[model samples]
Every structure is written in C-alpha cells, then in structure tokens.
Target: MRELELKYGCNPNQKPARIYMDEGELPITVLNGKPGYINFMDALNSWQLVKALKKATGLPAAASFKHVSPAGAALGTPLTEVEKQIYFADGFDTSPIACAYIKARGADRLCSYGDWAALSDVCDEATARFLAMEVSDGIIAPGYTDEALAILKTKKKGNYNVVQIDPNYEPAPIETRHIYGITFQQGYNNFEINESLLDNIVTENKELPEAARHDLLLALLTLKYTQSNSVCYVKNGQTIGVGAGQQSRIHCTRLAGSKADNWMLRQHPKVLGLQFVDNIRRPNRDNAIDVYISDEYEDVLAEGVWQETFKVKPEPLTREEKKAWIAQMHGVSVGSDAFFPFGDNVERARKSGVEYIAQPGGSIRDDNVIETCNKYGIVMAFTGMRLFHH
Candidate 1:
C-alpha cells in the first residue's frame, strides 16, 4: 500500500493522520492492531536503533521505546542467573534475540511499561513468549515465525499492533517534515558507527579494550537515534541508562548518571532480597521496589503503603547503602552525542561507574576533560563524530 491512515496524530484532537510514500509502496504491513501516530514514531526510531545495534555487534538486538526515545536497547548476551530472576524468566533457554529483547525490556521495566518494541532480527517463538509477559503497546520487526505470530496474536485481546517491515528497505538520502505550515528538510543521517570511530584516544590511559570498545559502540549507536543533548550509559551489551533531550550537557550526564545508579541499586542485595506478598504482581513489585529505593521512601513508608506491596515491612534501602552499592559498580561505558564543554560531565559520570567514554571531542576545554578522565584512570576516545538528533 502507498498510504496508511491513522486514527489520530500524537493526540486524539489532532486530525487527518496518515503515512505515505511518494514514489513506491510503503515498506511495512500492519498485521494486527491500529497503530497511532506516536506508536509509529516509536517503532520507526526504535527499529533504526536495533538495526544499527545488530549490524554493529553481529548479534540479535532489541529496543524498548517510549514516546520517541528508547528506554533501553541491547545486543544478544547471556543473562546471569540474577538477571533472569529479575527479568522473570528463570527456566527458559531463551534465543539470542529473545535474551536481547528481555534485557532491553527489563533494563527499566517501569519506564518500559506500555512501550513499543522493535527487533533487529525476525521474531521467534522465544521472543514472543517474553513479550507476552510484558506490558507493551506494539511491536515492529522485519518478520515473525508462525509460532511467534500465533503467540503475538493473542496479546492485547488479539488487537496488539504487529508491524512487519522490509529488512532491506532503505529510505532516500533526504527527508522532510512539516510543522505549523512550515516545511523542514534535511539529509538523512547515515553516519556509520564502527571500531574506526574509536581511533583517537586522548587520555593518558590509552586503553579501549575490546569489550569496552563494543560497549562504546553500543552507546554511540544508541545516541544516534536518541534526541539531541543526549548521553547514554552502557554495560555488558545493554544500555543501562539514557538521558535524552536535555538542555545542558551536565544535566544530561547527571540524568543518565542517576539512572545508571538506579540500575546498579536494583542489583543490590537489599533490593534483590526484598520479600513481597505471595501474590504481588510484577508491575506492583517494580513500583514498590523503586519507591523503596528512592530517597522519598519516608513518604511512601509513612502511610503504611508498604503493606499493599510487600508481605512484611522490608528494611528501607538507605542513602548510605545506596552509596556503598553504587561504589562497587565498574566497567561502565558512556557516550555523548556532542562534546562535553566542561569537565563536570566526567565528574558526574564517574560517580555512576563510568570507566570509559566516547564523544566528538572538539570542545574548547578538551584538555580539562582529558585531565579529569586521567584522574579516574578512565579511558576516553574522540570519535570525532557528532550524533545530535532532533
């Protein structure tokens, strides 16, 4: 089909929503459910992210997207036992793509709630089973197996949005959009991210290990599709945290750092051992655990709110405990879509265990930033490529 109409735009009041192609048929087919404007936005952007991830890593990839930004993205990697428990899949021999999707969706389940999913590889039964357990709006992938299609068809009472796109489809080099009767045009950003981008190591510690390089590539690929003024923290083939669309570089670092800290805090013994009521649902447990770990726990704890989510009054995860747990985190990689004008970004990222970094590295105070990395023995590379997205 050349065009597909939508029920509405970003909101219900916006009328006459549709997507079309000028010279050829649209590259996707809607197998189920009616996708909204925002759903399509999430799917298209996330699909690009996963596609880049898989191409960069030569592994299956997935992304959990909300609005137009990714909540998490990951490449296929073996999940630890603790990770399987938290992700709620303990006994399954998950496919590489399935594990990638689980890690992507599980990175921040709270943020991923009702998210749109995108997969790099064809959807398999294992991936469908994992998706079945999550709260999601829709999914977009290149293809789906028969078993996977059957399983996904049962989601959302058989109305789940399932989109299949041409794996080899590529858009024209230029793109255009309109806003308020004004048309905007630009060349599509097809900048390739690869090992060659990590050649310029300005830090005294000139060590971007193979794993660290892979993590750095993951972060850069994620930032390519993220909104402007974004930073991403990655570890072990997954984006642990992403801060997008911030005004200040330091704010981006701080925002992503806090999320990285939360990711680490979730694996803390106190958090992992929390005893919930026998029948507490996964979503409720996620919320309760987040609340228990936050500094605002006193507010949630004061009114006996814990009783609703936990069987017993679990010990509060105190600020001190949080600090101690975060301190132990290491081997993290950070990427910036643009240059860090000041050393403060480095200072904040270090607090969240960022040991390696990649950025365009043309700031006026590049020496200061390099000195800061030296203090922490952090290895940093100048990719010399800005990944600003809008």
Candidate 2:
C-alpha cells in the first residue's frame, strides 16, 4: 500500500491525517486495528530503538513507549526472583522477547501504562501472552506467528493495533516534515553505536567491565532515539530510567537520576514485602507503591484509605531509609544525548550509583566533568558523536 489513512491527527480536533511514501509503497502493513497518528509515531520511533538494541547485543529486544519517547527499553536478559515478583511476571511464558518486554515495561510500570510496544524479533506466542495482560494501545514488529496473532487479536476487545513492517525496508537519506506551512528537511541519523564508542575512555578510572560496556552501549543507543536534551540510565541490559526532552541538560541528569533511584527503591525489602488486598488493579497497585515510597506517604496511607488497598497498613519508609538503600545501588551506567556543559551532571549521576558514562564530550568544562568523575572513581568515555533527536 502507498498510503494509510488515520481517524484523526494527534488530537480529535485535528483532521485529515495519513502516512505515505513519495517514492514507493509504504513499508508497513496494518495487520489489525486502525492506529491513530500518535500511535504510529510511538510505534515507528520505538521500533527503531529495539532494532538497534538487537543489532548491538545480538539478543531479542523490546521497548515500552508512551508518546514519542520510550518509557523503557531492554534486551533479553534473565530475570531475578525479585524482578519477576515486583513486575508481576509470574506465570509468564519467559521467552527471550517476552523477558525483554517485561523488563522494559517493568522499568517504570507507572509510565508504561497504556503504552505502545515494539519488539526486535518476530512476535511469538509467549510474547503475545505477556502483552495480552498489559494495558497497552498497540504493537509493531517485523512479523508475528499465527498463534501470537490470534492472542493479540483479543486485546482491547479486538481493537488493538498490530502492525508489521518490512525489516529490510530502508528510508531515503534525507527526511522531511512540515509545521505551520513551512517545510524542514535533514539527513537521517545513521551513526552506529557499538563497543568502539567506549574506546575513548577519558577518566582516571579505566575499569570498564564487560557488563558495564554492554550497559553503556545500551544507554547510548537508547539516547540516540530519545528526544533531545535527554539522559538514560541503564543496568543489566535494561533501561531503568530515561529523562527526555528537557530544556536544560542538568535537569535531564537530575530527572533521570531520581527515576533510577526510584527503580532501586522499589526493590527494597519494605516495598517488596507490601501486601495488597485481593483484586487490586494493576494501576492502583503501582500508585500505592509510588505513594508509599514518596516523602508524603499519607496520601495513600491516611487512616481511612490505607485499609482499602493494603492488607496491613505497612509502616512508612523513611527518608533515612531511602537514602541508605539508594546508596546500596551500584554499577549503573548513564548516557547523554548531548555534551554535559558542567560537572554538576556528574555529581547528580553519582548519587544514583552511576559508575560508567558515555557522551559526546565536546564541552569546555570537559576537564571539570572528568575531575568530578575522578573524585567519584567513575569511568567515562567520549564518543565524539552527538545524538540530538527531536
């Protein structure tokens, strides 16, 4: 097909929306429901991320996307017992692609609610069964097995968007878009991310473990597709936190660091031990956990409301306890879409247990940033390639 029409644009009021290719037939085929403009936006952007991840790691990959940015992304990695419990991934099919998607969605359950999913490998029955239970809008991949297609067809009362793309289809060298009757064009970003990017280690501490290198590559590739002024924190082949589209670079560091801390805090003993009442909805459970971890636990634990969700009103986790637990988190890797103009970003990242970092490294304050990394004994690299996606 040369074109595919949409019900509406980004919003209901916006009209006359469709996607097409000028030179040839469109590369995607809508296997199921009609996807709106935003759904397609998330699907296409997320597909690129997972595609890069699989190419870099030689493993199945997946992403959970809300809006155009990814909530999380991950490669196929074995999950620990604690991870499965917190993610509610029990009884899952546990295939490689399913594991990747589960870890991606579980990275930030609150943010991933009602997200669009993207997968590197063809959708299998195991992956579809996992997607079936989540609150998601749609999915995109190269293909899907017949059994997987059957399972996905039942999602969202059979209105779920399922898309298949030509894995070999390549876009033109230049891309274009329009805004307010003005047209803009630019060459597509085709710079590759790989282990060689880490060869330019600039920190005094040069100990980049194999696993840390893997994570740093993951972080860089994730930031490549993320919106500009972004930061990504990754560990063990999964993105635990992503701060995208911030105007200030330091804000990106702080925002992504706080999210990384929250990911670690969720694995705390108190959080893992919380007991919820029977029949609690998934979103509600997520909210309860979030409120319980926040400084103001009273919002969810007020005298009359605590009993509604929890079996026993658990004692509030204190700030001291949170800080102590966060300090225990270690070996995290971080990446930035642009240069860090100051050393403050390093300070903020270190607080979230960052030990390795990757960035373009062309700032005037590169010395200060390296000094701060030395103080924390953190390893950092300069890729000499900026990744500023909009």
Best by lDDT: 2
Candidate 2 regions exceeding 4 Å error are none
Q: Which ten residues in a row have the lowest lDDT in candidate 2?
A: 298-307
Candidate 2 lDDT by residue in tens digits, 43-134: 99999999998999898999999989989999898888988988888878788898999999999999999999999999999899989988
Overlapping backbone residue pairs in candidate 1 total 0
Candidate 1's TM-score: 0.98
Error of 2 at 176 (Å): 0.7
- Going through the candidates in order, what is the number of backbone clashes in each? 0, 0
Q: What is the lDDT of residue 97 in candidate 2?
A: 92
Residue 217, model 2, lDDT: 87
RMSD in angstroms between candidate 2 and the native structure over all alpha carbons: 1.0
TM-score of every candidate relative to the true structure: 0.98, 0.98
What's the distance in Å from true for residue 389, model 1? 0.9
